[model samples]
Target: FAGIGDPERFFRSLRAGGIDVARTRPFADHHMFSREEIAALAADALREQLTLVTTEKDLARLRGSEGVPDDIVPFAVELEFDEPAKLRQLISDHLYKARERRFNTR
Candidate 1:
């Protein structure tokens, strides 16, 4: 979650999706957890009764590495656009205007 840009954004999306997480564990972007670190975090999670949740990219990389806990899970994130039709129309208008200007200049 924190491995992705804006850890808060990931939490916001999780809440929007109705995943009621009480707290977060943040990691630096593109962080690779060592064997000892993974073991320590996994033990802490077990002690705290918390699940290890992370972004898909982190899970992917972690899976590739040795000594990572198997319990760490990945969550998928999707961005939603507000007033998608209006945004599409605005983009279309901008593209048309730019095209007209380019053609007119020729």
Candidate 2:
């Protein structure tokens, strides 16, 4: 949780969800990391024995750069829709309407 948004919220969620985070470093949303900075952060994480877990969006932002250390793990948010059928129906309706309107132009 080291990119784009307050890491505190993530840490709080973790704690609430029963994760014991030793420490955290938050950065601006869509933060750009330099090779040197990444190296330092990686070293710190290893030295402190902290598991580096970040959002998938942040991992993607890194663009598979070698600067990103291997120990860093990508964390993904599980999307839980309240009503799957209703949500699916809404999406289907929106798509259907969009397609109908697009092709109806004569």
Q: How many backbone clashes does every candidate have?
A: 0, 1
**TM-score (all chains, Cα) for each model:** 0.67, 0.68
* Model 2 / residue 90 / CA error / Å: 0.8
Residue-by-residue lDDT tens digits, candidate 2, 7-102: 777767667767777877788887888888788778888898888877778878776887677767776667688899999999999999999999
User: Scored by CA lDDT, what does every candidate get?
Assistant: 0.80, 0.79
lDDT of 2 at 99: 97
Once model 2 is optimally superposed onto the true structure by TM-score, how far is the C-alpha of residue 31 displaced, in angstroms?
Answer: 3.1
Give the clash total for candidate 2.
Answer: 1
In TM-score terms, candidate 1 sits at 0.67
Model 1 sits at a Cα RMSD from the real structure of: 3.4
